[model samples]
Target: MIDLLLQYGLFLAKTLTVVVAIALLMMAAVRARRGMGGSDDGDRLEILDLNERYKSLEQALKESCLSKKAYRAYVKAERKRRKARDKAQTEERQRLFVIDFNGDLRATEVAALRVLVTTILLDRRDGDQVLVRIENAGGTVHEHGLAASQLARLRAKGIHLTVAVDKVAASGGYLMACVADRIVAAPFAVIGSIGVLAELPNFHRLLERHGVDFELHTAGEYKRTLTLFGENTDAAREKLKGQLEDTHGLFKDFIREYRPALDLERVATGEYWHGSQAVALGLIDAIQTSDDLLLTASETTDLLQLKYSAHKKPIERLLASLQSAVAGRLAAWVGR
Candidate 1:
């Protein structure tokens, strides 16, 4: 009977402590709301209200013996509130998305850029333009071809797209630059590399010396033009050369379709030239850096960089914080 009474007294003491903490939190929230002038539900008011509610609820949980269910409920509510706030803020602004494709390109970069372009088109104003600062030395035909196709989407939407080449935009990189409505390059930038090439290594002699032999079977006559371990024939070499020429023809045609004024024969010689020479050769329109253009335009136009970044959700952050707290306490006990 005495033990039962002691248990009851402890429960009542914990309940009273929780009640006092809740009362203090409510009072603090009320004071904060009043101090904020009880304004209409604007940005500031919404933020302040969320903060107060969060603080009060957090205090209640901390001071009382909250069950797991109640803790989860509070965390969900906080997450919803934060998500709503983030959506509101994101919708309130107009931004310009800049895609900088430098060095050798990769497929992942292209995928990230596809999403970025779609988001910008949906979020930006109708008149806003996208700036692609290109500096690619050149790479595989198909790899850069896909990159060029991504840029072409902007043109399909009738959105103004500009490409600025600073250091170099050769071969497949030039393929991408030509898709832009306006092409700007620094005076000494290397531009243009209108050609295609393929290299193959043969190890038939090496394998023959090692007493190893390999045979390849193909259903089609030109299925495999060149081989690494098999002997290469003149017919195979001619076929490969024809393929490269065909690809080069397509590259020249693409440029002609976009910039009709270009002399196809002169520019398609697999040659690269500086920006000034390129401008004279009709490869680029004017000489200008992206920074200079942005600085000058900022006087009248707003310069904004549009980016879509994934951040940890509020629930995830809260869970991480809770785990960290538990770990810290466990470590402290172990240390003692």
Candidate 2:
């Protein structure tokens, strides 16, 4: 099972690399157009009416079955019904503010998440709910920590904050998830990995054989506990392991602080679990997808999706183009 997970992890890494390459290409095009004084502005607070989608589907079905005159009459009645429904929602003074976080290992979405959260904080009153649809497999410590703090801001405002995981939210992702007032995961979604991991390759032996000298100076004793080229002493390696264990302790404490009901000792072993299993282990609140939650919430409240977009750097764009080109060639070769 561990081997399978490792293999799957590799596949996921490659898939995400491809996704990143494509996103970078699109961003580069946007950047070029903007450089030419194109009036293409970036992201804003988007309010999506989930009902509009369902309504369109309903109208399509009605149109296929009803005569032209009957369809026209049906459409007029439907408009009236929708107006009444919208009025009721306004009267109730309830709303659903949706945000999305597709996190990379670096947790790059944190910046956008912070912007969106602050916007919601400014105007969101009581009876207003926030929903975050998160897709992440965790990453660096401080990065995900900052991301989790962004979510924490919503709860700090005395507003209800719910998070839905449709695919995976392990490790640093779960670090952020545990901050939610409620967590909902799809049945097949990967949900838990209540542990910490750190790994690297050492090349000191190769360097020594090649008559290369590498010197790393640290002002503090534990400043550089592990290295890529310099020899790693037993004491240094132990210090690194100790640091990981300390991080694991902090992670467990964070989870317990937010969700004290979970049996942390039983499940915080760095083992990933499916949605149903996670629910049983008390790692999540419910077993349901984001789509279902949005559909159900939209029936009575106005569902608005919030997003934040920014510009990318030129060098980053160039690197992405190169990666995409290489990936494209490999794909073509595989096809042949």
Candidate 3:
């Protein structure tokens, strides 16, 4: 029976090996096909006309819900409005360029944000505004700082910028939002967390118990502090604490610079508040959702939603499909 089990295990391993080889060969063929396709337009900026989209929705609703007479009257008025709008083409209409940022721990969306900002800077006319519908629970310091700086570029160019938060924008996320000219958020959206923190578990005791030695060498006095695999000395702890305090101080200073009216002592306690509470704390200017703001603006102004999507290669597509399939299978197994 043990021998039979071993044979079955070997057969399974061989089957897996064959499957992997076939996948690799198929991926190579796809890569070759892509190489021959030429001219990858992966960095293209996609723009959606929110005005036309809203109009289409409104027209559809009216057609379905309104009386025939009301529908005809609405169509007539829309035609006249369209004619007048076309005739007044000489007068430049104000545009609200909308973008979205869904951030993770690394603020990976910054890559696409930079591209969108560059494109807008090139094509934007005077009186045009930008509305960033941002959703991020914060991440690393340098990455979020870079994202904020990108928004600052718009401010430098004298462009009006508004950041709208529907869910949460804590710590590093707030860092980016505070750079906007105006920040609007939903009533219950989370805001603030103006502080810094660094913590890690040390495995020195565990290693020592296992009779294993972990060595770390450094030249500078404070080269490494509160390491993962080494004993944390009091000096190292103090150094790390001092560094965190310094980072928190810098964060407070940054917030104060953008929002002079905010009392740093009160809000910079690494605590977050809902959007309505944030208004009282002066963390956000107003409590309004992005959808409402954009819809209202679309009445007289042209609202354009801009998105930058990277072109995926054939291998990426295949990998993504495989990942989805594996995830689905795991989910089903867990449910069962």
RMSD of every candidate to native, in Å, equals 20.8, 14.6, 7.6
Tell me how many residue pairs clash in candidate 3.
0
lDDT of 2: 0.84
* lDDT by residue (tens digit), candidate 3, 37-124: 8544566779999999999999999999999999999999999989988998898889999999977666767988999999999987
Candidate 2 lDDT by residue in tens digits, 68-131: 9999999899889879876776455488888888766677778888888888888877799998
RMSD to the native, candidate 2? 14.6
Over 1-336, each residue of candidate 1 has an lDDT whose tens digit, in order, gives: 999999999999999999999999988887899798973332210112223444576668654776777777767887898698677764433333466765353322455566667766676576777788887766678878888888898888887888999888888879989999889999988888777777777999999999999899999999999899998899999998999999998888888888899997998987888888999999999999987876555433445554433345689557656654553453233223
- Using TM-score as the measure, the top candidate is 3
Candidates arranged by lDDT, highest first: 3, 2, 1
Candidate 3 Cα misplacement greater than 4 A, ranges: 1-38, 312-336
Candidate achieving the largest lDDT: 3
- The segments of candidate 2 whose C-alpha lies over 4 angstroms from its true place after superposition are 1-43, 83-92, 317-336
- Estimate candidate 1's alpha-carbon lDDT, on a 0 to 1 scale: 0.74
Candidate 1 has a TM-score of: 0.62
